[model samples]
Structures are given as structure tokens and as C-alpha cells.
Target: MPPATATTPAPPTAGATDRPGATGAPGRAVQVTWAVATIALVAVGTVRAAGWLFALCLVAAAVTGTLAVTGGRSPLGMLVAATLPPAATVRALSWAVRGLRDTRPAGAGIGVGRILKSLAISAGLLTLFGLLFSSADAVFADLLTGLLPDISPDGVVGWLLRLALIGGGLLGAAYLVSRPPDLEGLRPGPARPAHRLEWTLPLVLLDTLFAAFVLVQLTVFFGGAGHVLRTAGLTYAEYARGGFWQLLAVTALTLLVIAVAARRAPKTTRADRLLVRALLGTLAALSLVVVASALYRMQVYADAYGATRLRLFVTTVELWLGLLFVLVGVAVVRLRAAWLPRLVVGTAVLALLGLALVNPDRLIAERNVDRYLETGRLDVSYLSGLSADAVPALTRLPEPMRVCALGQIAAELPRDGLWGTNLGRERARRDLAAIPTTTGVTDCPGTRRW
Candidate 1:
């Protein structure tokens, strides 16, 4: 679908009350409340996560993701959107101030000189503000180290950070690309940035390679993109690390295609529009698969499971959103199909709002507050970067600690002496020895494995 023009945003609501087939209309407060609530949650989460580095990673993820979504192409939007709230959120917001400085949104249909001027200002502001908020060394050092210094090669944590940052960059790019177009001193789509083939050829080649890989995996291996990779028993981080190539490919392809489609998508007939609708739906489904795969990966790792695992693809979510938007878009285009548009939009809004309220994550977050809470063993290793933490966190655990300690204690005991627990038996023997009727020594119990 093409980008929303400066005209209208979505379907109408007033007409919806007359019709019964559509989803109900949600109050305006629904969206408003959700946004404020979400922002508050962000504030709380930033605090709960603790440490400037973690916050920065998140800021970077959010910043990048915002850049990509608002500017870049559709599939790019899809991919970034799918990975977000985790990878995207973590990195965009991590250096958000810096991201705003280093990377900012640009507009279309603007003259080259003016566009460049605006971009310069945007970039300068983002950079200046970023510097004010975050330090250089403070963040980079933490990226290489897990918050827990001990978990040297934190495969899971590191992978999460990596995926989020990468997604954020892609999202930011998409946002810029999808923007109307630079206006100042520019005709459209500049040519003399030094290299055309350098950009196009590489993108084309990378996208092609990814497509081929996805095709191979889909046909000969999994039957289709969704079946094998995200069947079940996967975790979010696992899927991210395990199927990153495919995820990246799908996201890139989707964004590129959508970008192209938006630019050239024909509107000759209702059928053409329908085709676009179908295409968007398919894309949405793919996005859902990407998300589902990620969620499943997380679930597997966390020993968690949920109902919406398969529906996680961003495409799926957006597909539903598009349906409502489509009615609005079509109604706007036709102008004659008036009464039904509002009703359709209102219903869709209500449905979408309802979905948000019923979102399993909202419930999950509420239900498992204890697990999400920050409390556990004396993990000083994370703060200290102990040599032992470099070993897998699971490797040197409660059982291992107990087993090793017990064995060392057993080795030093005298074989000839009656075996007894160090404290109890010795105390018993000593206490008994003071009594005339008591024996000289008390027999100790056999050594026991802890």
C-alpha cells in the first residue's frame, strides 16, 4: 500500500453505529490511554532494567526502529516492526539522544539545498542532545559485556542486543526512505551521492541472496517459510540467533517490496486494489511468522508457552490494521461509498483497541510480575565479571556447587574414626563424654551426598 498522504488517515466511525457486522468502536480514550500507559511503562521499564548501558541499548533500538518505521520502506517497516519492543526498543532507545543527533527523519518533495539544510539541522540537534545525555566510553564498554560482567560471552544477551540494534538501523532507514522525498534543490531520488550501483547493486544482491536462501529453506527444508522455522519449541532469543538470516531476509525483502509497491502500486481497478490488499495481508502474515518464531524461541528458552505464538508476525498484526485502514482508504478514494466507511472504520478501531486490551503480553506481564522482578542468587559475578561466570551460567550452578563442596570435605576425614557429621556428632560425643554413663566416642553417620 502507498503511504498515507496529507489528506486523511483511516476509516470513519459515525457510519459504524448503523451497521452490525463490523467490530465495535472503541472510545477515543482507548488509544489515548494506551499511549500514555505505554509511555509510562517505558519509564518504569527503563528504571527496572537499571544501568545506563541497558537503557542506552534500549534507546538505540527504539530510535533506530522509529527512524526505520517513519521513513523507510514497508518490508523494512515490517521487519523492524516485528523485532521491536525487544531488539528494536532496546537499541533504539539506548542512545536515543545520539540516534536523534546521528540519525533523524527527512522529508520528500523538498528542494535539494533545503533538504540538505534541514537534514544538517536535524542531525546536528540529535547529536548535540545525544552528547548531553550519554557518554562515549560509558556505553560502548557495556555492549561487549553483559550487564553481569561475569557472563563474558553472553550468547543470549549479546544476540538480543545485536538483533535489536540491527533491526533498529533497518527501521530507521526505512523511515527515511518511505518519507515523501527530499524537497530542497532536489528533483527526486538524487543520483550524485557518489555511487548509484554501489547502493542499488549491493541491496539488490543482498536481497536476492537472502531470497534464494529463504526459498531453499522453504522448499527443500521446511515446506514453506512458516512451517519449519516456527513450528514450536523455540524461544525469542533462540529464533533471533538461530534464524537471523531468514528473519533479516524476510524483513529486508518485505520492506523493499513494499517500498517499491507503494511507489508504483497501480490503482487502475478495484481488483488492483484488492491485489494490493492481498499482498499486504500476505506480507503481514510473514511478519507474524517472524514474530511468532522469535516469541517461540523465547518461550522455549524460558520454558514458557502462549496462544499467540503463531500470530506474532508483524504482517499479521498490520494485516488486521490494514483491513480497517483499507475501508477508510477505499471510502476516501471512492467518496460515494460513504455511509459504510465510518461504520467499518469504527468497527475496526474497536476491534483493534479490543485486541490491544486483550493482548496476551499485557496479561502475561501482569500475571508473572514475580518472575520479572529483579531477585535471584548472589550474582555478584555479573557486576564483578568473575572468571567462573565466563563458564556457562547453567554450568556452575547450585548442584555443582553443592557436589564439589561436599566431595572436598569428605576427602579430609579420618577413615579410622567413627564417621559423623562435623558439628552434630562431635558435639554429641563431647557432651556425652562429660557424663559418667556416656561412651567415650559417638559413632558418626555415613558420608552423604548433598
Candidate 2:
């Protein structure tokens, strides 16, 4: 008789499981590709100039790439997994590292040792020639000396640590792709049956509370400044400052509650589905009222104070939260939209890109300058601390204020001749240099500090 043939199970796709080593050759190939891409992203992000936009872009890329490696099939699932608290990543990393023990050898060799030896030989030749030329010519010696790295113990350790971190992160990502963690919780599972009465009672109670809150917001929102002062018994600035952040926090928490309730709620029957929609829709609508209140309060606060970067960020967050609630409403209407997660992520990415395009530093500077024109109180100290992008806007201020602003700005502007300067810094330097110095601003106290 013929020998019995053994059967090997295929690797898991989206909503399945694969034993260790069952991922096969294709999975390993994908792992290598994703690892290379992740490392490249991290390297570019690290070397790029530091800014809010650069940091945001780096984070977005790194996070999305990590999620893709984590076995998320749908864009929505990947995006959701990406935003999950750091605990999820830590768990996934731990599992990936543990899975390293199960790694099997490939049936091939790449002769990496030979490649390393060749690279070492080439480096040695280059070093020998460099040293010979430096010894023969003083200019060459200085140039080579400037180019040579200072190989101190601390420097070496730091460089090694950086390399290790990059290597380890890449390895971890590759391991995840090859052996994905058992994260059933992160998967988009079928909606479980929820008891209609069980969900209805709590949702109704929450809905009633939200309704009361909306009524109060309507009074404050439509009644104008006088109503706020009359009901809250505080000045507009005081009321604005006290209520906006609290309302924002409340709205955020409410959103979380609604999301959790809807996700866990059973919708087996038609009545259950309708009930879920009605409850979530009502909550979303009330949340919008709260969002509007938060925005209005922030506007009032910004009008009273000035538009700082922090305030602008909060305003953006509130707006984004409002958009999220709108998306939630849509999801409720559709009932089983797997596309919601992707929509949320896309909305967030667009918002972040919009913010980067707006250029917060310049926006803050311009708005502050306008505020100074109206109130005659330029926060010279604050303006000085802004990034180089604010220099042109600062030039628009009055003579002494302009001089003060430019002087403080010039202190931080890039002074490294021209070899390594960026366009933004160079532009700022030229604009500052164009400001003709006058004796009047010399008496300004802030200019003295500059």
C-alpha cells in the first residue's frame, strides 16, 4: 500500500487562525517587505526637521504600518487597532517577541557575511586614502577632520542604542506580520445578540440626562452673552474658561459610553435594531449640542484672550469630536457598516493635514498681532518663543513691537551660515534682517532681553 499522506492546514487569512510555522513562505516574504517599509519610515521621520507637522506625519505612518502588520484586514479595523491605547501594542509586541522561539529556518542562505566583509574592505580602503591625503595637505586635513566623527564612549553608546532600537522595532514588526497575535478582541466580530430590554433601560436613562443637558446648552447657546452671565453668574471670560473644558471632557466621555453601549447592545430583532438606532441617534444629537457649546465657549475665550497654539488645538479637537459623533449617527442609520472605522480614520487624517497646512505657528503669530493692534498689548515674551514661521507675521506689528519681536526671533533663528539651513529658517533670517533698527525700540524692556 502507498504511504499515508499528511495534510497541512493553510495559513489564516482575515478572520482565521494559523498555528506557528503555518504562515508559510508567502507570509514570511510579506513580513520582510513590511519590515523594510517600517524601517524606512522611521528613519525618514527621525532625520526630518522637527515640527508639529513632521511629528504628526511620522506618528500616523508608523501607527498605520504597525496596524497593517497586526493582521487587520479592513482599513477600519487597522485604523481602530492603531488608535487603541498603548497597552494593545505592548501586548502584541510581547506576543511577537515570544513567537520568535517558534521561528523556523528558511531553506537558503544569502551570504550576508561575505557582503559584510566586502563592505569592510571598501571602507578600509577609503579610510586609508583619506588619511594619506589629509597628511599630505593642510586643507585636506582640516576638511577630513571636520568630516570625521567624534568617537567618544558616550557617542558610541548612543549611536549603538539608536541602531538597536531601529533594528528591534523592525524585527518586532516583521515578527507580527509572520505570527500575528491572538487579538480576537481587536477583530471585527459579528454583532452578538443583545437583549432589547437590557440595553433599553440604561440607554433611556442616559438619553434623558443628555436631553436635560441639551436644554441648558440651548439656553446658553441661543441666549447670547447676557444669558450666560445671567444664568452662570459669571463674566463671559470666566464662564467661558470654566465651562468649555468641562463640557468637552463630558462630551468625550459621553461619546465613549455611547460607542461601547452600541457595540455591546444586542440587535437580533427588528425592534431591537430600531431601538438601538433611536437611542444612539438621540445621544449623538445631544452630543452635538454639547460640542457646539464647547466651540462657542472656546471662541469667546479666544476672543478674550489670544489664539495660542493650545487653544487652537482644543478647538480642533472639539471639531473633530463633533465630526466623529456625526459619523456615529451615520453608523447607527446603516446598522452594520464595517466602513465606519475607515471613515473615522480618514476624517482624522484630513483634519491633521489641514492643521499642518494651516501652520499653527504663523496662525498664532498673525492672530496675536491682530489682537495687539486692537488691545495694544502684544505679548512680546510669548511671540518670541514661537517658531521661525512667525517671523514674517511679527514684522507686521508696530515699530517697537516689531523690533522686539524680530530681535527675540533672531536669537533662535538658524545662524549656521548656509550649509545646513532650511528654507523656512533662511526666509525668516532675511525678513528679520530687512527690519531697519531704530533707537525707539532700544528702550523697550523686552528688547533688552533680546
Candidate 3:
């Protein structure tokens, strides 16, 4: 999933770099100062506004810390939702620390190993940062629902995620309570299958149930052969003609394939194994491609329109990905075919390709600026080069250029929005109008007109 592009605090990190004494001391001191300041402010706030507000923040922080410390699996999500501003500040700071994590080791100069370690650590920090933001966002409860009038907010899917987290935690706790004695009791042994039918059976049953849902949905949605399966006076024909039916049909097919494979017995033949792997691989790849394509489309829509497009539920593609994951999970449990593993590999490849096609690098660069436009970091340098080579072309740009090429041109305009984006924008508007629907709109792709 695309990481939240919100202005978060620095990425998370251990911040254990061994830097010069001077720099390290000052940096550490600054951090300490900030921490002290935060604590003091909170304390003062508590003392002055010691009523429900201070008590609330304290209670909120305590609950969040408790949840995190307890390994609540869902993270301190509720706490984050309650304090988004503070969370954003802290998260941004965390990311900043991660970016500066490899500044130096005063005693030991940079080395190959250090370089690699730094890279790994930086990536890990960023990964953690993303997770933190995602978890925080997930806890929205209903704060945003009030802001967005179009969305119903807090749908069935969100309920599922919450339930899963809570159930998993409970299951983990139960397993730990019933776990067999540890290494001290073992004279000698290698790893054994981690689970038996007790675990496997339930998951298998769940797969079966999901597969059944898919099948029923398919019949209802597809109305294949125009066969109407109606209930309660609502004809399947009426429902199946819409987009929902097509999606359900596709999803149902995927589920049936998984369910069938799961119910089948495993074979020992090499050829059989290979075939199974290939089929699974292809299925997985296509699924991933669909997901990537969907995400890219959402990104485009969001940029062209506004983030409000995804204010409530995520894009359709994301939901499809979830369904895809469930389908694969079913397959993994039932299908021992050699082809199954390849499905995941294919999904990875196809997803990458789809994403590349859907979201070209140039578009992404532009969108990045659009997303951060509020911050005044809308980098319009994308047009700088075009200006050089296409200088003449820019000057002669058509009228409609302003609307189509707004991304690149707007940034160049003064704060007062005067002068309008270089001539290209003006040209865009003009060209869009004069150019018929048959002709594709064009622009100076270069950053400058050399």
C-alpha cells in the first residue's frame, strides 16, 4: 500500500550512531531539551488546566503506551487518532532522526559495512514510520466521518480488521498459556511442524466458508448465461448488469480456483508439482497486477481531484487486494501444488509492471508536489528543462494549457497567482480547446528549453 504522505514527524530509529563527541553531545542535548520541554509543558498544562483536558491527555497517553507495551498487535492506534497533531509532530521527528541516522561515527570513518548497515537501518526506520502512520490512521473511529459528507465511514471491512487484531491477540495469549514446556525439557530435537489439525482445521473451515460466499456472490452477480438467481423479489438480472456484478464474478472465480485446489490431494510427481506452481504463480501475478493498477488509478484520481476522494474507505483496488490476499491464503492452506508459490512471484512482477505503466515517474513527481502543495514545496523544476529546449514552443502554447498543465505551471506563478504558469500553461488551455477529441493533448515534457 502507498505510505501515508502526511507530514509526519521523523522516522522511527534507535538513533545509536557513534558520532563526534561535540556533535553527538549537542544533538543528544537538543533531544533531551525537547523531551524536557514537552514534559514540562504537559505538566504545566496539567497544573493549569488540570481539569478533564489534562487528565484526558494523560489518560490517553497512558492507554496508548499500555496498549503498545502489551503488544496489542494493532499498535497504539486509538491514542494516535486522539492526538493526530502531536503524533504528526513526533512521527516527523522520528523520520528526521532516521534520515540523519548515518551522519558519522567520529572514531570510525565510513566503511562498506557501515554504509550497508546505515542503508538497512534507514530503510527499517522508514518502514516503521509507515507502519506507525498507517496504524494511527486506522484509528480514525469517526473523526473524519464528520468531515466528509459523502462517506458512510466505519464500514464492515474496518470492523473485520479490528476483530482480526483482537482475535489474533487473544489466540496468541491462549497459545502461550497452553504451550508445552520449552528447551530445558528437550534432550535433542529439530524443528517440527508448528501446528496440527487444531490450528489447520479452523483455518481450512474459514477458507471453505469464504469460498462459499464467493460462489454464492458469483451466481448472484454474474448471472452468467443471463441466468437470474433472484431472492426477495430482487432479480439477479437487475444487479448483475452493473459493475459490482462483474467484480464479484471475477472475485468468485478466483475463490473457486483456490477452494478447488485446497480440496484436492497433494501429488508427488515432479511434473504435477511444476504445473501446480506455474498455475498458482500466474494467478497470483494477475491478482497483483489488478491491485497495482487499481492503486495507481486511485492515486491519479486523488491528485487530479483531491485527497477527499479517499477520505473514508480506501480505493476499490485496495479492497480488491485484500480479497486477493484472502484468496491466496486459502490456496496456501489447501494447495500443495508446485505452481502455487509462483502465484505470489507473478503477483509481485505484474503489480510492479502495472504500477509503472499506470503511474509514470513524471506523473508521480508531479503528484508528489501536488500532495505537498499546501506545504509550498511544489517543485516546478519539472518544467525548467522544457523551458530551455521548448522555449519557443512554450511561448506559443495554446489556451487550455492552464488546466492540463496546471501542475507544472502554477508553481512558477507568483504568490498572487499573476503572470500564470510560464507560457506553456496558457498554451495548454488554447491547445486543449482547438485540438479535437481525436488528437491527444501534448506538452513540453522537458524541464527546460535548451
Candidate 4:
């Protein structure tokens, strides 16, 4: 025997981890759970009409599908993880098709083709017997009719098409779950820090600019309407509208600048880290003021001309941006931002879900209606264009305004099937049924667009 020699195991090959049974593959039970979840989420669309409910279903499906494929083990940033599922689903389609094609039995296992054939035969026999019994007994026929779904000939093609598309998508997702991609390998190397002068000067200048803007904002806040009219030679609404978009742009650009500065700032020493925190932290704090100013401008604008979708949406976005600034400030203090990416994405998803739950259309209608009661200024045409979600609120308006606001919505209200029903539309239908249908208002006052 050769004098004791040490043996080393070979290193795993590239992409080996992406294969089935590899470390990245989800366990069988996990796969089944996620698969069922995915199916249930997709099935929601077949049952619910498009609205907030559909939006929620979409979000759930995306999350569950991503979790299934990545096994929730992706090392990539949350932004990348959010986008990976769709691409993975598309890439796995061919693999799923090939799998279905090659269905020969392994060892003592049953063949897929044999199982499918047995199922087909069993279904055919059951159908034949069902038809024979239906002709033999009227009560049995009625019971069978009640038990089976009514598959109309007109909708059979569409139903089959939907089934095939959803089935194919599910199959692709299943394949990806069994064999996740090498996402960890795709994560980029750490960024190289810029030279001190390279990143420092821009950030310092930005801080100075933000400071100047904050000073102006302070002056405006304390100065009030008289100062704005005198200095800018513009009314409150004019001033608000003029600067709102510009301030929004500035806030967005400031966030980008902070991100770049944080990424490029060197942190090799305590002094460097402290400086980074001081500059970026101040910028984020000032950015919060800018967010506040943008929101205040929108409030003035909405006060001048009631609430609309655009104004409400922008306000929500500004609020989310304000929260982002707060998050950045916290991340800066800790000198550890690894959690920032995921938290940012999570907060965004929550914000969107929150917005949906609040029923934006309804909110908009309610705000406009309240403003009308106060200022006697109601935009009937605009309210009429709102979705069925606003029906309940719009119906609260006085006679002509209520009729005008609900005419279009009620006219366009779709009669969704049992599976395609939505709470919002159902409520709208019930409310509309109770109200008289005389088109009693030909010309609604304040029909002008704001």
C-alpha cells in the first residue's frame, strides 16, 4: 500500500446547484404547498371581477410564484427577486413541454401516459352512463344538471383557452420549483468606492442645494398667502401648481443622488464613515422637507379644485417618498444598509396594497362630494367617469348631481357571472336597482373639468 496519501473531494461543477435534488431545490412538501397556493391565486381571477380584488390576487400570485421558483433562497437584491419569476416561468416552458413528452416509466413507477389513458377512459365511461341515466330518469337528470357546471357552447372555446394558458403557466412554474436557477451566482460583486474628492464634492454641493431649498420652503411656510402673492405675483393656487411638479422632480432626483453618494462613499475609516453619515443623512432629512412641501402644494391645489385621481395618487407617492427618507435616515445611522433594499420593496408593496384597500375611487368621490357641499363646486362629469367603486359615495350627492354622476357608471356596469362577480360591482348594481332610472338631468351644473 502506498504510504498514507490524503484525498480531496472535487469541487462542485458550475450550475450543479441549479439541478434537481440540489441544495437550492425546494423540498417536495414545500413545492406542493407553493403549487397549491399558486393554483388557488390564479383561480381567483376566474371567480372575481377585475378591481381591487383582482389587483390583490395578482400581487399574491406574483409573490407565491417567485417563492416557489427561488425557494425563498435567492441572494439577489429584492428588486431582482421581484422580477425573476416571470423570466423563469418563460424559460421553463420548453422544459415543461419536454417533460410532458418524455413520460416513460422509471423502475416500477407507473407511466404518465398510462395514467392519462386510464383517466380518459374512466371519464368517457362515466359520461356515457350519466347520459343513459339522465334519459332514464328525470329526477336523476335534474340532480346531475345541478351538480355539473353549465359549459355553454359559446364560452367553451374561451374557457378551454383560459384553462390551457393557466395550465401551461402552472406547469412552467412547477418545473422551475424543481430546478431553481443559480441566482446567488448572478449577484454582482461589491461596488468599488470612488476617490474621496470624486464622491465628496457632489454630495457636499447637493447638501448645500438642499439646505438652500429648505430655507426657501421655511420662508414660504412662515410668510403665508400674502407673502406668496406679493413675492411671486401669483395666487396661492397658481403658486402651488407652478412649483409642485418641479419640487416632485427635485425630490425624486435627490433620492437618486443619495443612493449614488452612499454607494460611492468610502468607509475605510471612522472619519470617512462619519462624514458619509453626516452628508447623506442631512440630505435625506432635507429631502423629507421637500416631500412635505410637495404634499402641501398638492393640498392647496386640491383645496382650490377638489380632489382628483392624479392629485391623490401624487400625494400618496410623496408620502411614500417621505417614508423612504425616514428609512434612509435610519439606515445611515446604523452604517448597515443590507436590509434597506428588501424593506424598501416590502414597504412599496404594502403601500400599494394599502391604497387598494382604501378604495381610491371611493375616496376621490367622497372628497369631491364633501368639497362640493362646502364650496358648492361639484364636477359632475369627472365624478361620472369614476368606477363602480365610487357608486355608493356618488349616490350621496343631491338629485341632479347624483343622477349625472351615476349615469355613466350604471350604464357601463357589466353583468358579471357568478364566478366573475366583484363586491364593488355587486354593490353598485344593488344601489342602482333601488334608484329611479329617469335621465332627469340633461345639463349638470359644474360639468367643467378642473
Highest-TM-score candidate: 4
Over 4 Å off, model 4: 1-64, 71-76, 106-169, 235-238
* lDDT, candidate 2, 78-137, per-residue tens: 655465435444555666545543434565443444445688999999999998998999
Residues 1-450, candidate 3: write the lDDT tens digits: 988787878754543332221125543453343334334333423122112233433433332322222211111222232234333334444443454465666786774456667989998996676656656786552433333223226545655675765454334333322331121122223224223343345445544554564455456445532353235343332332233434435544655564455444233566544544545444554544444433443444454333321211244336545455555755554454333432432343344334323322223334434544444332234333221112222333333332333433333422211211233334444543443322243552322211
Question: 237, model 2: CA deviation in Å?
Answer: 4.0
Write the number of the candidate with greater TM-score, choosing between 1 and 4: 4
Candidate number with the higher lDDT (2 or 3): 2
**Best candidate per lDDT, number?**
4
What overall lDDT, based on C-alpha atoms, would model 3 receive against the true structure?
A: 0.39
RMSD of each: 21.0, 6.8, 23.2, 5.2
The total of clashing pairs for model 2 equals 1
- Write down the TM-score of every candidate: 0.28, 0.73, 0.25, 0.79
Q: Which residues of candidate 1, in runs, are more than 4 Å off?
A: 1-42, 52-54, 57-240, 301-450
Model 3 alpha-carbon miss at residue 429, Å = 1.9
| Runs in model 3 lying further than 4 Å from the true structure | 1-195, 218-222, 225-229, 235-428, 433-450
Clash total of candidate 4:
0
lDDT against true structure, model 2:
0.69
How far residue 392's Cα lies from its native spot in candidate 2, in Å, is 1.6
Q: What is the lDDT of residue 369 in candidate 1?
A: 28
Candidate 4: global Cα-lDDT? 0.75
